[model samples]
Target: MQDREGIGKIMTETGKIVTETGKILTKTCKIMTETGKIMSKTCNIMTETCKIVTETGKIVTETGKVMTKTCKALTEKCKIIKETGKKMTETCKIAKE
Candidate 1:
């Protein structure tokens, strides 16, 4: 009778441990599922950010091209004005002579 009672007690303890282990495994699976969802959302956000950055870079490049053309036009106008001034000065000197 004593041996039978001891064996039953051991079986009960083993059953409880198995139940606890099953609960732990279920919680771990839930945590892993939540983590996967978060990682997917993070990847989507990063993709959108990359697209926006690419568009901004294109706009900046186009704006730089326009500014370069404007600067070139202004430089050409300055050269013309300087040449005209020199011609006028030469005419004035000849008149004084």
Candidate 2:
């Protein structure tokens, strides 16, 4: 009878340990699910940030092209003015002679 009581006590303790382990597993699963959700949101935010950076790069490239075009136009205009000035100086010398 004492042996049976000892066995019963051991079984009861084992049952309690199993129940507590199951509770811990349940909490761990919940924490993992929340972590997954947070990671997913972080990935979405990073994707959006990459898109914005890509768009900004394109805009900067286009602006560089426009500036290059403007510089070329200004250079051509200055060349033409220089040529005109040379022709006027020659004409004035010829008239005086």
Candidate 3:
């Protein structure tokens, strides 16, 4: 009779362990589902960030083009001023002679 009781107690303990393991597995599945959702959101955010970077690059390129045009205009003005100075010096030399 004592042996039978011992066997029954062991079976009960094994059943309890199985039930606890099932609960743990269910919790793990829920955690995995939540992780998948978070990953999806992260991908969306990354895509938006890439688009912003592309737009900023376009703006920078346009600004560079405008600056180049302005620089060319200034260079042309400098050349004209230099030529006028040379002509004035020639006129002064002639007047002194």
Candidate 4:
């Protein structure tokens, strides 16, 4: 199993975003917000770190787009994502948005 628990982790489930000060320590741990995604290398936000409230590969934000690998359909977790009228790929939108 993936090691979700680390030196500063308390979560008991997978894909649970960690909001600790320094629990997150990689680029894969994305920072989600209303405006867009911040690929924070370290846990820098005041209270957010790798914190995806819903599920993995899904984001909670306003005016955001989280798409699938085909860039055609939005993931179920991203179905509510406001249509910014931007055609998005999962990786690009997550990084560029």
Highest TM-score model number: 1
Encode model 1's per-residue lDDT on 21-79: one tens digit a residue. 99999999999999999999999999999999999999999999999999999999999
Supply the TM-score for candidate 2. 0.75
Candidate structures ordered by TM-score, highest first? 1, 2, 3, 4
| Candidate 3 clashes between residue pairs 3 or more apart in a chain or in different chains | none
Pick out the ten consecutive residues of candidate 4 with the lowest summed lDDT: 26-35
lDDT (Cα, tens digit) per residue for candidate 2, span 33-76: 99999999999999999999999999999999999999999999
- Runs in model 1 deviating more than 4 A are 1-5
- The TM-score values for the models, in the order shown, are 0.76, 0.75, 0.70, 0.11
Total backbone clashes of model 4? 0
lDDT of 3 by residue, 1-97 (tens): 9999999999999999999999999999999999999999999999999999999999999999999999999999999999999999999999999
Residue 71 C-alpha lDDT in model 1 = 97
- Displacement of the residue 6 alpha carbon in candidate 3, Å: 6.1
Candidate 3 structure, TM-score to reference: 0.70
Candidate 2 has its poorest 10 consecutive residues by lDDT at 86-95
Model 4 spans > 4 angstroms off: 1-47, 52-56, 59-97
Candidate 2 runs further than 4 Å off = 86-97
